[model samples]
Target: MPLTILTADRDLDDRAADAVPLPHAGADHWRRPYRPGPGRVGAAAVSLLLASFVLLSAVIIVAAGALPAAVICSGVAVLIIALALRFLRVGVWVSAHGLRQVELLRTTTLRWSEVAAVRTVQRPVRWLGLPRTVQGQALVVDRQGGSSLRTLVTDHNGDFLARPEAFERAADVLEAWAAEYRR
Candidate 1:
């Protein structure tokens, strides 16, 4: 099965925005659009490579008269394809309800009432025990220790460094909306 990112109801989001009192809430909602990012491209390449390897291995196993091995390889190939599809859809979606981080096989959703704070954290890109570069502006959500500091925007989902300005704006919207709704 191909991985599918659930698209929020735009009509509903618009309606919610009207009902809510947050600025830029209606027309300018935050969504992780399928933009061409390095992480996204890399994920595609890795998935393709794994799928190709599985196909070749399966062919070889069948030629060697190992039916069981061939079957296992086919299964692995299916899994690889599914994983790749999911990776393609990885993103964060924000609506009036709250936020949704779409992953390979799961989604983490936080309601507006559940959010305690939104903050930025700095991360380091390290190699051989040294920080060669720093990961700029990771947006985290604090659910008052319930979920600790959950990163809503990061390279893992093709946000943050991938689309810094958009990520920042989304983070601002989230924090402001949460604060307003909490009251």
Candidate 2:
């Protein structure tokens, strides 16, 4: 007698179809349409590097029999790592539920129903989220029944810095998503 193994016969699509859909309450439900630029990535990289050094110094301090100093260094390392994570998370995210603008210290979310229009405009936008501004295009979000225009994505932001084509494509995708979901 030959031993045989039995398995369910199903295609990939069938298995995928059977999977339960995830709830739209978190980052998993959102999509980033653009890539982070060198400035943001570089800052995060530098932060991680500093954290590594701090961790190494902590280890050395522990070997040198200074427990208190080692603990402090470890804490600093943890803070640096957190900062790097924050840098990585700063960006614009879109979904059927809404549009999200994530900053270093704040996040703003606008539902599709609240959005009046998402259009590209020629204006001065922050350079890499800096105080200094540069002449560029921005994806402005107009709220329903409001005169204030919220700037969502900018050509000079981390995602589209020095990438004009990517800015255009991302703006179009965001506009399309707004159009489709607003109805």
Candidate 3:
């Protein structure tokens, strides 16, 4: 169905997951895909470079008769491999029904209606386990849609990844979906 848009105060509070009744955004609401922030995948390359350096160093030290040079080289190799994996581990994606949370360890999806709230907060000097963003950080979307009981999805792992600056994108998609379908 064609949708009509409104400018009412969209005051949607976040809450835990349940078979909650959907809110009424009138007849003008529409459906759209939630776009998440874009992720900059530069770390993988850096990891490879570091690994090469580590190997090169290991070779040089071994030539100089450094004891246990093989062990040191193995350590650098492991570090490089780990960093590369983490780099490949980042991403962002969304759908009409839910958002995809991508991480080094796993990926998850959350539905639209369960999105209780999306708040953009500062990434702090140290967020999750990294440096702060020059621009204010994205947001943490609370949802009861995912399989996991913990419903918070943070951008540290490209949870709402549309463009990194796609806060409005996410909110818009979430609003559109919620307007049309509720939970």
By TM-score, who's the top model here? 2
Local accuracy of candidate 3 as per-residue lDDT tens digits, 1-183: 422233111223234223353676333333223322223334566677788888888878878888597677869788778867755545444455565555667776656667665555565322333655433454466556533323233444343333343445554554454455444
Q: Count the backbone clashes (under 3 Å) in each candidate.
A: 0, 0, 12
Task: Select the stronger candidate by lDDT from 2 and 3.
Answer: 2
- Give stretches of model 1 more than 4 Å off: 1-36, 103-106, 121-135, 144-147, 155-163, 169-183
Q: What would the per-residue lDDT of candidate 2 be over residues 1-183, giving only the tens digit for each residue?
A: 422332111222356548764575553378876666667888899999999999999999999999999999999999999989998888888887898888878899988898898899998989977899999998988899875455888999887777787788789988988888899
- Estimated TM-score per prediction? 0.57, 0.80, 0.41
Candidate 2 local distance difference test against the native = 0.82
* Candidate 2, pairs of clashing residues: none
lDDT accuracy of residue 169 in candidate 3: 50
Runs in model 2 lying further than 4 Å from the true structure: 1-28, 147-149
Top model number, lDDT: 2
Range of the 10 consecutive residues with the lowest summed lDDT in candidate 3: 2-11
- What TM-score does model 3 achieve against the real structure? 0.41
